[model samples]
Target chain A: MSGVRVILDQDKCVGSGQCVMTAPEVFDQRDEDGIAVLLTTAPDTGQTDVVREAAALCPALAITVRE
Target chain B: MTSDTVPAFPMARAAGCPFDPPPELHRLQDEAPLSRVRLWDGSTPWLVTRYAEQRSLLADPRLSADVTRPGYPFPAPGRPTGAQKLGFILMDDPEHARLRRMVTAPFAIKRVEALRPAVQKIVDDLIDDLLAGPKPVDLVEAFALPVPSLVICALLGVPYADHDLFQGHSRNLISRSVPADQRGASFRALHDYLDRLLAQKTADPGDDLLSQLVTRVQAGELERSDAAGIGVLLLVAGHETTANMIALGTLALLEHPDQLALLRDGDDPKLVAGAVEELLRYLNITHTGRRRVALDDIEIAGVTIRAGDGLILANDIGNRDPGTFTDPGTLDLTRDARRHVAFGFGVHQCLGQPLARLELQVVYSTLYRRIPTLRRAAALADIPFKHDGAVYGVYELPVTW
Candidate 1:
């Protein structure tokens, strides 16, 4: 269960909101400028697949999903 | 380079691979002529990558997209079969033609053209919402992505409140990394939800797309499942595809500053339409091609494919084939990019295509003319590209004016 991890390079994140769009529960963001920011430092088990998608979905390659 | 060329690029590979398709597809077209590709599922089926061959094959009846009936090529082991084989679009022959025709009336070029004024208003509203906030706005969340979702909801007659549920599932099922095995569940869940919503529409019809379909279906003409099939298809295809186009299309326009300026200065619908085609061709999303199964022994694009073998028509590569377009790799809005298969080809060509095109042309023209200074908020390399999914699209494209 602890094997799941997704690291987002915020510097690389252009806030496409794709990761959040793909897995909203796993990836949430601030409405500061309408872009997403992760709300949870550690995503739950149900979010494992979603996080993987969020990472894969990122256009900037900002997200790195590690399992 | 014979029957065996380099391995065909799988969707997962394309998502992450920093490679372009023209060279890879060209090599296959020249060398393999007819070749096999490894799909998300373990099965490796023959692919037709050349321009003439792909078109020739797409138009051929021997190939089938429906995996429902027997004598079809089912998925191999754990690899994904499409989520419960939707009807009509993936179906062959008269069925595809028949079903596509049902809703085509509402989506005709002229019908969609009439919707342009309304679509422009939607774009303006979303853009206003984005600007109402602050800088570094994620175009995907604020404007580029949600506008299409909202429009489709209104078009389909789905209540605005239900978007969160359906959109969440739709996003998950389309993501490349969600695994082929999981899509079936996500698809079924959505279908079940729509089935109930559709049944309600049958009882209490509205003027939206669902109610219209329900009225036709209850007349005992179109099957209820077929009606539901159309609903499900539109539910997902109606928005996500357009959302991706807007996000990626905007990125493409920004990348080509000259093209962006072209839109800023022109009000010509012809020019806008041509630019939309170029964007569709250049940013073609159906990268894996429409899935089709051969009914019997056949030879296509110069290769021998037997009965029960699968067929794939690499739309993205075909749209980019140098033979089809002069300097296919470069983005030239002025180029006559018509006849591209970004909406797909043959009987199964995208039914929502005209509607999608209308949304694209209007938004592209309006977005730039209103905010001429719109530019990427981050570096191209700084932003990541999608690595997996049923659709090929960018994640988020942030922009600032």
Candidate 2:
């Protein structure tokens, strides 16, 4: 396990889906409004790099990751 | 504040290098990353030239994209600002978020990925028409414009036959040199057209974007005028930006046969996707920098931007910042150019980017391979570039196989 804690601030998310596009395994968008929904709060070791990438790529600065 | 010290905004590109950004922007990036530049109205806004500063400032909540605010730099003297005409995209948060969310589902990554096959079909059908058409056809008119126009029409349920009505007005809307009254008239025309179309969708709805908006309106979730405004924004932005990228990307690729051959002969999907990103980073269709005004006093990079100060986030030069990308001037297709701000950044980052990427990927992957001998029929100097328009692209690309 990566022991990575990911927090998504829905209020701040613009729903651009940069996170979902960057790390699909760890994130997805709500079907109703396209707001991001986390698929997993703690990503595996293999998914850590891409999860961090999703956090960085997010335009709204909505994603926060604690390693 | 002297004219000699402060260079004017929208600086001209080099005479021979139509693909590169204005040379002055490069110098500004090197000497002073954030410096003042005069707009058409004699207002000096801070022009952000470096990539790092652009991304951070664009994402800063203190910088407002709302054009209605005072000191918001207008690209031209009397041109109608986007906030005056377009909805959501030009507004600030809360209100911007409310309107933007109502139509976000259709353009979500999953939703757009599902549209890949359909987008592929659109590209394939257009290429078929191009192959059958006469030699030396204007690719801009024949292929580039129609591909996105057709796809957007199908998505929005706007009849493609009405393209002439919308496209003509769209041209007027984006042109900086167009008279203010003429541009206002174009805005009204498109707004009224979409307004009526929304009414029709209400009477007989379909499984398309406008109908979706109609549903929101009926449920008391959105206003009719705002719905129409969103329609106009999506319709105009959907086609215009992509069409330019298509024609200009083709021109760029043809100019570099080595890069063109890499895309043409290679079948790897990753290579094709990387090529699309590189082209977007290089061409930067939105040539006029992203405009904003500081809502609160902010300090960064050893400078204080007072409230009401205007800013021009020059993404064209920012994309070419050597600090971010290696050998930024060279058009290398294989480089990891994903961080480029060609699409702009922050909450206002392009909503339709997934769709844009899907369309470009399909076209870049399929076009060159299908038409191996696709070469430019016109000389570089003879081709007309879109210097007058807000977007940067060639006006017409004449090509022959």
Candidate 3:
């Protein structure tokens, strides 16, 4: 199976870090602003589940994960 | 124990255990995850106490936070007249989300993290003042209330010099026992004051949140009334909850010397973060349950909650649910307590949480490290707990080194 691609709208991101907290491997926060940055837009198979969960739980609805 | 009558909601905590929830709340969680509880209005609402039930139900679109909705549980005695014109905290979906999103940027993790140095300076200056002042200082006045109050004032572009005006009125506004007219009067005063500030910011914008909203208003992105509504909400919510948590959390740590010792010596950021989460879970300062009304029939835990049914989600009980947390009552800093619903859940979950967390992190770490000998000046029994208030905390936490 192919990996999932994560897209983050930085402007809308409230920097809750829910995405980074949920899938550390796929997402990391910028040091200066705490906005979400895609560590890996295409997360590998094992990380796909959590990457999706992070997108779903984001309060600002800033993250989008597409196959 | 099948009886036609239900236990009253807002049950009192067990005698002498000031930190824990009412024994009856735990009992209900044990016997039935979902059960009915009578409110002050003599109406019975379903009280959901378990973590799973609370999380799901809070997230359910079938449930609404709109105070105007039929059967919406009004936790406190006051009717909160003209609540529809107030902030979105009491509104549902589109309106709530719209207003909430406008203010999210300021409290975003990065933004709050950036304020860490300013927050640290605030904490440090307050501690210096406390140390130099008379022994047995009231931590609430000296530290807890001032830090968040100043921070929120700065964030909203309000002058800290006007603390006496808003802080006093905020106390009345949130007090569960204050007369309805008094609370309403206080709310109106604060609302009018903020509305005036919003109008001023429109003419002369500063570099604060109010200025940002003013810019938005000028750009035709937001209404002046909505901006003022948000200002009122942020001013109240920003200071009060975090202030209570600071006072209560410190007292909780003081009670548990073992945890305090770790926080005092342990320089691990991860450990400090975990300790904050544990304290948030254990204290659960929002003692009154989160209120809602079911918009549609929803089945959970083998019972169906019908449409128009009032529901009170007891966050204190769920935070202490043994099913979700290990040895939930005991304050274990090492426990994975991040999942606790101390901030409530779903869309209405506290928007100021990021800033609150940052402030707590700085205060807990710095206070213990600077004054290693900090101890209670007065005995725990002598301290007055806010049992009658909407928020759970000590009125005055006297402390000395």
Model 3: DockQ against the native? 0.25
Q: In model 2, what is chain B's TM-score?
A: 0.98
Worst 10 residues of 2 chain A by lDDT: A1-10
By lDDT, the candidates rank as 2, 3, 1
- Candidate 3, residues B158-238: lDDT per residue as tens digits? 999999999999898888888888988888888888889988887888989998888878889788777887888899989
List the DockQ of the predictions in order: 0.01, 0.82, 0.25
Model 2 reproduces a share of the real contacts of 0.72
Residue by residue across A1-67, what tens digits does model 2's lDDT show?
A: 3469899999898888889988999999999889999988988888888888898888899999997
Any runs in candidate 3 off by more than 4 Å, and if so which? A1-16, A21-39, A44-67, B1-4, B83-86
TM-score for each predicted model, relative to the true structure: 0.79, 0.98, 0.92
For candidate 3, list the clashing residue pairs, or say none. A33-B110
For model 1, the DockQ equals: 0.01
CA lDDT, candidate 2, residue B248: 96
Interface RMSD per candidate (angstroms): 16.2, 0.8, 4.6
Among incorrect, acceptable, medium and high, the docking class of model 2 is high
RMSD of each: 18.6, 1.3, 3.1
**TM-score for chain B considered on its own, for each of the candidates:** 0.91, 0.98, 0.97
* Highest lDDT scorer: 2
Winner by DockQ: 2
How do all the candidates rank in terms of DockQ, highest first?
2, 3, 1
For model 2, residues B100-131, the per-residue Cα lDDT tens digits are: 99888988899999999999998999899899
